[model samples]
Target: MLDFFSSNPIIALAVILAVGLAIGQIRFLGISLGAAAVLFVALGLATANPAIQIPPFVYQLGLAMFVYVIGLSAGPVFFKEFASRGWKLTLFIIALLISLVALAWVIIKALGLDSMIGAGMFAGSLSSTPGMAAIVQIVNGQDPSMVGEPVIGYSLAYPGAVLGTILVAAIGAQILKVDHLKDASEEGLITAPLVWKGVQLSPEITGKVGDLPRLSGQSIIATRIVDDPHSHRLADPQLPITPGMQLLINGTEEAVDKAIAALGEERETKIEDTELIYTRLTVSNPEVAGRTVGDLKTVEHGFMIARIRQGDTEVVPDRNTVINLSDRIRVVVAPGRVAEVRKFLGDSEKSLADVNLLPFAIGLSLGLLLGAIPIPLPGGTTMSLGFGGGPIVVGLILGALKRTGPITWQLPFHANRTISTLGLALFLAGVGTSAGAGFRGALTDPSSLIYMGTGFGITLISALVCAVFCMAVLKLKWDESMGVAAGVTTNPAIISYLNGQTGTDLPNRGYATVYPTAMVGKIIAAQLLFLLL
Candidate 1:
């Protein structure tokens, strides 16, 4: 068995991934490693046969692919946040990370541990795969033998980091008697409920659809209008409105109520008929992607898009609503025009699932090139972004841009997620196999336990700092602070647990708010920790 695995790396990898993922799926006290389990599985497999090795390119490609996708997903929100409250949050995270590094330094000194191992422990305890990659690159720049040394420390500390943060959040919340859900409900911070409503136009009202009164700073889209009792049409700005007509709108319930009060009497109206109908379409066509709803030429196509659902958030779309790949848009079209609209939007599920290789390849190539470029440093020494940093940096920029001329740098949401998972899994498995021999040796060392304990301490400290700073200083809610800690740790398991406890996406909001910055920050911190050691 060992010899077979040693000979064929592909078969070995498949076995490791399959087994690891299965192991991860087993819930232990309501927690699972999810994709991170692949690492341990690969490590165990490799220990049985030290010759079982995957090529360097596989891991390198995996690292680049993983971080690049993360960058793309984070770019839009990261920039938007920076423009608002990101500065304070960014500073807080940086300080917290630096403090953790200092703490790790102290522990490393006390234990008399190797600097390389200490660096790996720091990365592992913080749950940063990118950090581990960065450390390996700089440390093993000349010597490949040292590559496995750090991974041993990473392995010891990885579990501690994951479990420690979760424990702290749960225990800390209970100790404080903080009712996260109740607090949110009381604060009116809960997400608004969406609804479709109708308003019967007052006899005194008469104007174009855009002239309708609406809630200030709230979403209220005029989707359809009933002019004659027998016929209904899309609510276009050019479409004239007369007395005794019903305007059908979709938006948050509160926003709709206010608009209905302003427009006329609230009424229930059936808008769909033979002449006009609406259908939901997945935006999979490259030609239409990155274009706004108005650019679709709805009038020319005898259609009007009223709503769009992107991931978990849904919005009443406008002319300038830039359509992204995999967005589900509600389009009201002429009865006979559904086929044409479907073709134009590329509504096929197959198209939505399959990635456009042209743009993906080009974007990845650009990221690789960026990573290779030498970055100048002080004292004539130069640095590079390497595999971990380069692709992510490029991804962030392209993600924010969304499109350039004709090329959509961003992939569909599903495609991005799929590629990200594949990349991360491959990288973890490869790293595990590469470092397996050293890890096996380290298992018997007394200091391995010390590293594990130290990692747990670091995670608890970091989690505490994040929670305290977010709640006490930033004045955020308990759930949000815990969510922020989860993001800082860069572990999805922690956030998933929080969601289960809270039964709301409020925690997810906090997680996403800082995830991008925290991810990039932790990567830099890991490298800095290595250099400092």
Candidate 2:
């Protein structure tokens, strides 16, 4: 059995992972899979096996999808949040990162480990794959097996780190006893209802209050009183009644009793025909490109184009306003005519089909090409153009800057979600496969175990410090503070878990805001530790 297991190591590892996942021990799967992959590679290297290779293209594709989705999720608000509330979180995270680098340097010096080993250790401590890649790039001519070890270490550490962070966040929220209802109300998630059972006239209604007897004691205001009620109502009727009234109606049980007891006369007002005629629809067809808003009128659909939103800008569209893919259009049509308009626009199932695959391909190619370029670092050292910071940063910047290729590139949200989920799952699977093999090695080395322990310790301490700073000094909400903490720690899972606990989606936004900064910090720390040590 032992001989068979040793002979078919990868398969054995896969079987273990499958069992673990089936049993709902997802973390176990991660650890097992990662260990298996690393062991496979290590054993292959030991035996001089040429077949053991991580396909660079497959890895790149997974990484690109991961980064692009992350960037998209972060969106424009990430920068805004950073500019606003990111300072304290950044400061604490940076401080911790610097401390980790210093600690790695000291440990490396004391242990007299190989330079490559120390670099790998530093990268592992920070869990920064890009940093590992960078270090490997700088240490040219190093054994490929040795160069790969740091990435393996990072992969091994990630699931544990994520799980640990999520646990901590859950504990913190429990300790804080964050109330979901109160938080939601504070965040304006609870909106006032549009209509109430009764209508009330305020004391401020001085200028000959219209038909007071008709609306004197009813819950609903007559729709016919105003030709356009939407334009006139300053506030929704469901709100609490204000003072000063020509006619007032009550809604609360006690208030209704008092009104009835007072023998207030009841009058019903006639309903009006003032329903909204326009509804908005996003442009989904690739063939519709270069067509104007006026061209839309040529279709059999009886609708008038009202407005268009192109990216962040909203325009009062005219005939010459070209209809581009992903442009959200507001069209006014007769009541119950939405189906006709949709029919004319073609199948609703075809929206994502319009995404110009060319631009995405171009962007990806540019990322790969630029990522592959070996640019010299600060110390006359060159790094490879790979899945590291240089390529992703350059790709994102260039992609954002390019304007002429496609007027509108709509990210198919559903497709993007599907791709993101798949990429993440595969990436996680790879990490797990690699970690399972290295788990034994990592545990066996006292010094390496110390580094891992210290790394986890630093992450927890950093998160707590950031949380404290955000809450006490910055006066951020507890959820937001926790979110900032998670972000600084570079674990979105924490934010997601905390959000789940709070029963709100706002924590996800907070996670997104902090993730990019955390990524940058981790990479910087890893590299600095390697270079300085």
Candidate 3:
């Protein structure tokens, strides 16, 4: 079995992924290792056999896909959060990185560990494959003979680092005695996503739907209005709300509840035979592109924009929410007015699926170009973004930029996720197999345990300290703090755990907000750690 796998890297990878993913699903105490399990599975296989190594290109491709997708997903929030609290978040991430590197430095120096080994440990402890890659890139340019040192240290430290992070997150949350669900609710994390609710208009309720208060920044769309006779019509915001009427309201739960308090009781009425038709129209009309949601004269056009489906997430667009090309928007309209609404939104599902691959190709090409460009350090050394940093940086920029004329730099939600998942899986398999031989040898060296322990300590301390600081000093909520901690480390498993606990995407938002900066910073820091040592 070992000999067969050792000779066939492709088969080895498939087996590794299959076993790893299956293992990842085995939840213990409500915690699953997720894709991080792949790395360990690969490591185990490689460790058992010295020759089970895949090509470097597979790993590079995987790393690029994972990082790029991450950046793209986080881009919108990344830019938004950066504009508000980017510096603070950035400083926090930088401080955490510095602390981890500093602690690792002290331990490595005390143990008389080699500089390359220390670099590997640093990258591994952070669970940053990009960081490891960056270190390797720097080392290759300076001293090719020392290339294996970082990988060895990284592989040895990797398992402990990932586990330590998970432990720190769980333990820290326990220590804080955090009621994640309640805390998330109070922090308005769960309410971030727009949801639909059916609201009835009472006798006391007066005025048109448009006249209702905006209700704490939540956008309210009355999709269908059921009159006293149970006849339903598309809700024109300007249309007066009669007494004993029912409304299919679209907004956040909090917003809907608030509206209910002011208007009428909550009703779960399904309106299928109504004159009001609900349909999702894909935006292909060039005139609608770049227009804000509020700018679209929906009421005048005999329809209401109920929800805007942008990629995987559905957004309840406020006045400021910009409409882009290929955005599948859910609009409420009369059957006769369907043609008018369709014309306005371009109503083509085919267009939504018709992805122009040029932007991705161009963006990646640019990213690779940027990564290859060398920058000189003070000591006459040089560094570059390499494959990992380049594509990610480009993806982030394009994602944040959202669009440039007809060329939108974005992938469909599912496509991005699939690509990213495949990329990370391939990367992890390659890294694990490559490091397997070294990891086994390191275990026999005695010093490997010390390196692992030190890396583990760094991971724990970094996560714990960062979490505490974010909560205590920055005044961030528990969910946000955990998210930041996980984000700074660039570990999706931690984010997933936190999100599970919180029952919200708050952790994900926090992770996305800091990920771009953290990724770039860590890449630079990894090289610096090696160079300085």
Candidate 4:
């Protein structure tokens, strides 16, 4: 049986995922591991039979995909948060990491353990793969025989590190009595409902549609215009508006009313007659994915975009709004142009379900290339972001850009979630199996137990301290603080777990804000632990 399974590693992996998902669904004391259960299941199975080894490529690929999607999703608000509180969060995480490294140094020295073990302990407890890699390089150069030392130390502490972080976050949120759903809504994470009004241009009104005075910060879209009783077309801000011309405006109630007052009085009339109509359809077109609303020449095509819906969030799109695949957009179209608009938007269900791999592949390759580039350090040494940091850094930047030239850097909401979840599962399962043999070997030795326990203790304390400092001193919300902790720890699993608990991207925002800096800092700390001590 072992020989057969070892020959068919793919089959073994499939079964593990199947069983893990089933086991994850079983709640114990109202707590379930969810997708993270895949890790433990793989660990146990591999411990029994060391021959059931998975390839290293599996986890590395998974890690890159998971983080890249997270970066893309979080990028929209990451920079904004950093601009406001980036320094404080950056400094706070740096201080926490430095303190952890110092404490680890003290305990390691007292135990008379090797420097590599201590370095690995810090990385393992924080679940920092990049940190582990940095220190591993240091060990390899100094003493090639000690290369295995860091892996052993990392493996012994890894299980506790993943599970312990989850517990700390759960307990901390529970103690705070946080209302995550309410918190998300209050922070404008959810979009407001839209309203539309029919208006007739007032005689006093003049100039192009763009020059109209609107309520400050209002998001109003001028959808359609009436040049005559029988002649109606989509409105363009560049087009000159004359008195007695009617317009259909879509926006929030206040914004619509304000636009109506600015343009003309409201009229009891149908903006969409039999010929001119409005249709809300999904954006299933790959060709249009990267283009902004203005770039589409909506008015030239006899259509105007009103609003857009993606996942649970709704948005009022302006000229600058970039259209993503799978978006449900409401547009007003002129007479006899419905087919043209439908064709342009590719209103096909199949297209909506399919993932566009072209941009995804390009973005990921760019990230890998960026990761492999050597970065020089102060002591004539060098480091890189590695797989852990590379994808995420690129993801965030591309996500914020939304597109570059013709390539759309963003994935659809459903696709992003699916890819991230699967990638994370693959990464965790691979890690568990790869470490299982070493972990089991270490378990029998009493000294190894001490090292593992020390790792777990340091992980828990660091998380607790970070949680307190963020919420009490920094005054960040529950999700935000957890996001920061996960970021500083450089563990995708931690942020993934928090995202499931909160059901909001607010945590991702916090994670992205500190992720790049924290990851680099932790790597430096790990190297210093090896080189300095």
Instruction: Give the candidate order by descending lDDT.
Output: 1, 3, 4, 2
Residue pairs with clashing backbones, model 4: none
- Sorted on TM-score, highest at the top, how do the candidates line up? 1, 3, 4, 2
lDDT of 1 by residue, 13-113 (tens): 89988998898888888888888999999999888788888877888899899989888888887777777777778788888888887888888888888
| Clash pairs, model 3 backbone | 62-423
Taking all chains together, the TM-score of candidate 4 against the true structure is 0.80
Q: Pick the candidate with the highest lDDT.
A: 1
The digit string of per-residue lDDT tens for model 3 on 66-134 reads 888777767777878887877788888887777777777777788898888888988988878899988
Overall lDDT per candidate, in order of appearance: 0.81, 0.50, 0.77, 0.76
Candidate 3, residue 265: Cα displacement in angstroms equals 12
Write the residue-wise lDDT of candidate 4 on 1-533 in tens digits.
66676688898788778888788777664456566678678777777786777676787788788778877877766666677898788788888878988898888888888677777877888877657755655565677545546756876676678778889889878887889988877775644468877788787777776555342235687776766656666678798878787876777787777777666698655654545777888888777886888788877777788888877567778777778878898888865788889988988888767777888898888877787788887788676766666787888888888888767788877889899878877776766666566656766877888878899998888778878898799887888888887887767667778888898877877787888777667766777676666
Error of 2 at 418 (Å): 2.3
**How many clashes (backbone atoms < 3 Å, residues ≥3 apart in a chain or on different chains) does model 2 have?**
24
Off by over 4 Å in 1: 183-193, 201-208, 211-217, 238-245, 272-274, 376-382
Which scores better on TM-score, 1 or 3?
1
TM-score of every model?
Answer: 0.93, 0.64, 0.84, 0.80
Model 2 — TM-score against the truth? 0.64
lDDT of 1 at 315: 78
- Itemize residue pairs with steric clashes in candidate 1: none
lDDT of 3 at 118: 84
